[model samples]
Target chain A: MILVLVETDAQGATLVSREALTFARETAARLGDQPVHAAVVAPLEESMATLVMKQLGEQGVAVVHTADDERLTTYAAAAHAAAVVDAVRAEQARMLVAAGTPRGNEVLAHVATRLEVAMAANVVAVDSVEPLVVTRQVLGGSALEEMRLDDAVAVLSVAGHACDPEPAEVPTAPERLGYTPSVTDQDLVARVARTEVTVVDDTAALTGARVVVGAGRGAGGPDGFKDLLELTELLGGALGVSRVVTSLGWRPHHEQVGQTGSRIAPDLYVPCGISGAIQHWAGCQSAKTILAINTDRDAPMVTKAHYAVIGDLHEIVPAINEELRRRK
Target chain B: MANVLVCVKRVPDTAGEVLLSADGLSVDARHVGYTVSPHEECAVELATQVAEATGGRATVLSVGSEDAVEQLRNALAVGCADGVLVEADADLLGPADVAAAVAGVVREREAGGLSYDLVLLGNDAADTGDFQVPVRLAYALGRPVLTGISTCEVQDDRLLARGDGPDGTEVFELPLPAVVAVMEGGVSPRYPSIPGRMKAKRAPVETVALTAARQGSGRVRLKLPPSQPSSVEILGEGPEAAPAVVDLLTRIGVVGR
Candidate 1:
């Protein structure tokens, strides 16, 4: 059997989780239709649980397991790993999968350590299930490494944007199992004391936005972002900045996109005045289309972009905004 | 006083172009220079700060070939008091074996009455991209582990860690004898002075051989990703490009024509 750890947001299962489910469904088919189970570490609130189960069933999960408890509302890494290890044992799963998000990788790392098993993280492709051959990105997504799992139980995390989420043609009504694992004080040693939400507009989330307008050091200063913000507003998108901009105190770190910042996979990424470093490109390379606007023609961003405009962003942004306004 | 251990790896400087080896097992390091990964540089700095603030000692450790002593000395030049080299070919050791070696070192030190109050590591190594060693070592030692931490403080009797979440910064508090994988951007790592480098050159480094059984991750080979086809069409120069940019945006459906 194969097990997948499903991560849910406030509404329901996240896109990355669905992507993992989609990958799991295909992997299971490749392994002669091995049974695939989905597990969630949450409180199992009735309505949220129902929605999540329905979604997983639609994704062709054969069984759904929930480690429901009030304390699990906020993630405790050790506790979640304990629950996952128990689920893996109960399902007799040979392979376990999760998204390569921060939480997903962290939780699965705990599981791997607790089980003393091998985990292949940021895996982009799964070649086989028996020997567990997989391809993962390395060197900040600049290169790929093929690895095989030599352990009895293999744990893997699918990289973000590796697979497109597709619903099953014929959905399965999954068997639901509710479990409550015993937690110890040691397990709660690194519990989250508090979480502060900074997002003012839901549509402005860097990762979820459809279009992102990026500013960098070339954007000049804090006042320089005013036109970019206007342009982002006109394009119905979000405003993103590079690390230098944030370091210079022109923008918040939350708006930075890079290896150390948010990784975004938007439909359209318009990077204005941004000279792309490898660290910055690692986050935005997944965009379907990239348009770079910069004065330096030799900038990495301009060379790698699908389209380029060699110009000053300060002058070009307001013009685009004006044109967009006229069209509206 | 607290005793802190910081784990570091020597990785090819990623600032330059990286080329893959012929067998695809590793990067070709003939022309490329090696240095500590960015995150681990911060980890060494943080360990030094914590040890200094708490009136303790900070030690650096590496599981790599003889050349890895260079990285260990780099840490020592910064602020680490001592260095330990677990003699092993880093290429031959997977995360499990690395963790086992570290755990072995920890046990040996503790047996010698040098119990570490805290263990520090980079969030993930730059080359292997393995996020397993710190957690695995923590589990082996039966201690608490926190990864991707940006800010850490040594309080009276506990360690406080803060990291950025999807929402905002998430705070974590753990007792001593904890393990933390620190991320970059938390603290600026300082460059070593001439005197510090000279002192580091004279520092005695303890060398230990790892007898742990090698548990391979079944790595097949390494390969460069297929380069994306680039056919960038320059629209125009200066402000004159605004109309073309708008047209292209319209064509891409980001704006209505």
Candidate 2:
């Protein structure tokens, strides 16, 4: 069995979890069609359970394991680790995979260390020989390294937001499985603090959008971002911000792209007044096409872009908006 | 309290557009000078804050080459009284092996019977950005962990952290003797002065390297990041086209159905 552990919240399953599940399902299909276990820490209320399975099944995941023990209620890395360890042993897990999000990285790291096994993190793809080989990015996005880890039970953390969660058009009814924690006092030590949760207004979130219009510090601020937003709506996409723009707190972390932030694989990435830094580029490196607008002709970001516009985004953005409107 | 062990690395300034060898894989070390990684600096800052609040000793550690001592001295300047360098030639090893090398250092620390409260690391290396080390090291030490912590505080020996979660910003509090990967801006690392630098230079630095994946893993290929193509398409008019644009807007799915 291939265990694909998912870290979820009221915001639903994270992009990374879904991506990992997708990867796992593909891997399973490759390895003689294996079973995919989608584990989440939640009370198995019928609707909630159905929603979780629906999300996973859409991505080719079918098996479902829910850890509902109150002790497993919150985001306890140790508890999750412990629970996963038991599940792995019980299921005789062939390989363990989770999307490479914050939680996925931490929990898998612990499992790998505890098992004294090697882990491949930030894996873009996996190739198997006598031992399984994984390809992952390093040094932000500048380098790609390949390694074959030789362990019966291996764990991998997939990249976050690598792929948007697309619910399978044909919903698969999830089979509910229960798990009891084999976690010891050591596993239970990390305090899992529960707090009131608030939801993100993703109405404008750029996840999986066909087009993303991004603004940098030079767009000036929210006003420039507003122009970018206007353009996005005109283009049928979402607005994106660079690390600088988000640090200015002009936008939330979700809209921010970088190694330390979200990774967007949009069809088109339009950068405005944003000086592309290596960190920021890592998030959008997977973006299909690039369009940049900057006043500095020699700006590095312009060079990284598929199309560059050397002009003031302030004047330039409104003009593009007008042109798109005129064309309409 | 958690026995936390924080790992940090020294790296050169990456934003300067430094070029690697023609193979384009390894750093053209002659030109670049090393500095404490930004995320690692955050690691030191966050560890110190948590240690101060929890009354635990925040032990700082690193793995690098001889000149890496210079990097260790930087951490000391950040107010980590003591530092250790698992001095190794990390030029060729992949992250899994690097994790093993770091795990050896932590094992030595544990065998020495130092009671750790937790283990922490920058979420990723500033230069390489591989995030496996902390979790690997933590697993080697058999502990739980947290990663990408943006905000952290210690209360009653439990570490409360706020960071980028899957959905949004999620909060987590875990008991001590764990691992954490610090992110950017979590805390401001203090600046080192002439005296701090001088004092750090005098302090003894520990150097250790476990056996790593051997030389010639296969020649690595280096190439510049693929170039993006772009052009500036100047629009016809400004706000006057707002309606025309707004009309196009509904067409694009932004303003209307």
Which has the greatest lDDT?
A: 1
DockQ of every candidate: 0.60, 0.33
Query: What TM-score does model 2 score on chain A?
Result: 0.81
For residue B156, model 1's alpha carbon misses the true position, in angstroms, by 2.1
Clashing pairs in 1: A148-B218, B24-B222
lDDT of 2 by residue, B96-183 (tens): 6666676776677778986676667788776655566766656666766677777777777667787765445667776655677778
lDDT of each: 0.86, 0.68
Candidate 1 per-residue C-alpha lDDT over A209-243 given as tens digits, one digit per residue, 9 for 90 to 100: 88999999888988888889998988888888887
- Cα DockQ of the candidate 1 complex: 0.60
Off by over 4 Å in 1: A198-204, A221-223, A246-250
Error of 1 at B126 (Å): 1.1
* Top DockQ hit: 1
**Candidate 2 structure quality by residue, lDDT tens digits, A148-210:** 666788778776554555554445566767877676666666544554348563522565576
